[model samples]
Target: MGLAVVSLKKGEGRLLKSGGMWIFDNEIATIMGSFVNGDIVLIHDFDGYPLGKGFINTNSRITVRLLSRNEQTVIDEVFFEKRVRDAWEYRKKVVDTRSCRVIFGEADFFPGLVIDKFSDVLVVQSLALGIDRYKEMIIELLKKVLKEDGIQIRGVYERSDAKVRRQEGMELVKGFIGPEFPTLVEIEENQVKYQVDVKDGQKTGFFLDQKYNRLAIQKLCKNAKVLDCFTHTGSFALNAGIAGASSVLGVDASALAVDQAAANARLNGLEDRVQFLCRNVFELLPELEEKEEKFDVVILDPPAFTKSRSSIKNAVKGYREINLRALKLVREGGFLATCSCSHFMDYELFTQTIGQAARSAHKRLRQVEYRTQAPDHPILWAADESYYLKFYIFQVCSDR
Candidate 1:
């Protein structure tokens, strides 16, 4: 196929030169002939000077996600193999264990592909058209890399349920890539044990990116009464219980998730201390307030409310409502671990949203710590915008 040319207007090439990956729709001077989604494009200045190579997706606001700056570099199977192998090499050296985010999109220079390695197995999610088009080759590269690293290849599972796939006109795929499916795998972080279910759980069966934040909660949960809202699979509650919380209450709207949370609590033998509740958090929060129920530690880890710029206002409202209610439900001097995963919502806006929530609830907050995605989920420094995950551990007070 001939190289699809993408000409950027005037100074828009600065972002690309500064190591940014995304080229928004507004940046394009011309689409330059018809090109299908996921086609490799050669980005150039108006004068036809080569800028870089990237994966094109006209459907997305981010029209192109740059893959390489080298004009000679071809984004073929060999190129993908080298990128995937380089990602694995870094993980092996930096990550303390076998389980980690093996591929982190732009951070690894393979835009729109995220692979999480759990022991011998790899769970992959191709969120962009470019990555989806090369799924087979990527899988092949992953297998070769695992074998080269002397790691047994259990299977590669595709967990592409993310909304981005749908936007890219791809169907949701979840299944084993190899012969057999691994039943369970254990991962440890900061002395806490977590059982990951790559086949049937949320987001490759675990939120490994929150590993450190969970451990932070564990330290604060000692002898405390904990409440974990939107407790998918009981991770936060179970961790608190295992960390010696006197009692933990986990609430989620999904009964399936609640059931899984209970099973996980039982698996860790913490069912005696951790309780699961299947209920809408919005309604439950008010009820808890009415009942005068308060917790020493409250976790608010809701799913991303905003996926696009259009939904940002509603997302902020939802976030604020939940944070305000949770703040009210935490005892004075208690801890509130709050988080937002919406990339559209910047950290400053998120902090401001929480501050407004606290103000409306007539509560004061002292931020204890600020956290982001785990190390395995590396952020590209040039693309500061890619650092989407945000966590704030705050101490609630009555000095409003």
Candidate 2:
């Protein structure tokens, strides 16, 4: 049977034509042929002009995720091999390949599919039904490509258990993709070692997007008293300790994360200088301020306060509150590192919110540097979702 054809309404596919990957359900004008929900389909302009090809899923608000702009490009093992190889090569050139985001979903041209490499293990998250069908082939091709580079993948694990799967009419499932190996994988980043629990840890076990950001804080931390808020697994704190910080306090609400972080500190032999505490950072910050406890450097790496645009108001408030308290904890002429991982909190809005926090705290902020997610997690232009992280370092000073 011939493939189904999807035609876009006039002026409806502006995002798609401008290089974005998604075509929303409401933008489609008609389906000219019959096909399964997850099958590949041809896309066309309303005036009978061929546009491209993509996989279709009526269950999703994103109706079509374009696979290629070229109408004749075939979706097969050869095509997948090229995509996998290209993603790997790009990572090799731009970031550390020892452990990194090998394929970053939409940014790497594989919509709704994320593959993170932890040492020799691969954790896969397939979020959309359309790409879920081709996931196995993509993994095989990726493994073959890595093998050619003298890298042998020990195991492949699936973490397609995010809540977003329900929106695609798919059940959340996670387990070993092939043969099982020890889920406890150890990786080294910026000379800091970590025991990443691929089986039970958060978001494929670690946030590799902050890989370089953690490295960027080393110079600012040497011999400085540092406080790392929301320190999951003590990544930033551990980096500080490794950088010769006088003392580091890493705080998180999760006791499990605290324990793992302590273990990581021991792994690096920095347990004496770096301590893990299980406490609410929001409450702890105010207490520290009341006690006049100051830090030479304060790092705020909170989770996304809002994931959607509708709750941005509350998100802004949350961000502002934390930044205000954190600014108060920084000693005069000390440094502050703050970041937001919510794409909904765009660069401008996040920056503005921080400025409000500084004004409210009666502090002057000297901008040091601004950064985003590491090079491996490349931000695809026009595809706004891929550009989620916004990081900034500033020197905090007394208003005088």
Candidate 3:
């Protein structure tokens, strides 16, 4: 079939005009050519001016995901090769090239694909249905690019098991894209070691986006008692222990994650200084408060409370509750490193929530520094979802 044409309503192309790549269903006025859903479509304004080319799907609310603004561009294997090369080049310049996010979906201009390189292994997630069709091509091209750099990806694991795929009318998939390898892979970052379970771990096995943020606590935790809440795999706690913290308590509700954290602690020879606890952080925080327990440093790196904008109200409350409890549990002049991973809870809203928490806890916060996800997880200005992580380190002062 020839390329389908999608025309936007008058004045409805404002977002696409302002640099955003999404063309919502409500924004479209008409489709000029007949084509199957998930087909490549040419997007145009009502006046018939070509805007760009995107993959269109009637199943998802995000109807069209613009692949390129250049009207003359071709969507083929060569295009994907260049995209992968560009992503790699950017990573080499701005991030730790060893084991970082290679393509951050829309942030890397790939729209619906994410790739992470862990040593000689790569994990891929193709979220949107439109991109799933090109998944094989992308994987093959990426392998070629890596081989040119003298890196051989022994295996490619697909973690496209996200529930969001249902909205795209696609089946959830998880397995080795190529040859099978041990699902567990070990890698190091910020002088800390981790055993990433690619087949079963959260969000592509390991959360590489927090690579440097975990290292940011080295100075604040030296010889001090540290508490890491929602410590998935105990990354922050391990960093604190390795940084010479007197003692570290890493808490997580998941027994499996706690076990993994313990294993990582042993792997790093930090078991003596770091301990893992299986408990709900919200429940444990109040219990610790009741015991008048205080820590020199507290790190809150909770999973996203809400994924949709509709739940932002409840998500904000959750953030505030945790922040308030952490602030109250910190020793005077101590540090509190808290963050929200929800894109719905944007920067302004997150900071405002923390302020409210401080007031309620009768504590004052001295802003130490504000950091987002590591550079490997680049935030595209036009694509707001790419800028989800909001990390802030603040000194807690007693109002008393």
Give each model's whole-structure lDDT. 0.86, 0.95, 0.92
Better of 1 and 3 by lDDT: 3
Cα displacement (Å) at residue 276, model 1: 0.8
lDDT of 3: 0.92
lDDT value for model 1: 0.86
- Lowest lDDT sum, 10 consecutive residues, model 1, at 183-192
Misplaced by over 4 Å in model 3 are none
List, residue by residue over 1-400, the lDDT tens digit for candidate 1. Answer: 5787999998786777788888888988986766888888888888889988888988888888998888789778888888887888887787664678888888888788888887777888888888788887888888787887688767788888877677666677777676777657776555555677787888888888887788889889999999999999888888899899999999999998998888878778888899999999999999999999999999999999987789899999999999999999999999999999888888999999999999999999999999998888888877876698999999999864
RMSD to native for every prediction? 2.2, 0.7, 0.9
Model 3 TM-score is: 0.99
TM-score of each: 0.92, 0.99, 0.99
lDDT of 3 by residue, 145-232 (tens): 8899898889999999999889888899999887789989999888899998899888898898888888888989999999999998
On TM-score, the stronger of 2 and 3 is: 2
- Which candidate number would show the highest lDDT if scored against the true structure? 2
Residue 250 C-alpha lDDT in model 3: 98
Summed backbone clashes in each candidate are 0, 0, 0
Candidate 2 off by > 4 Å: none
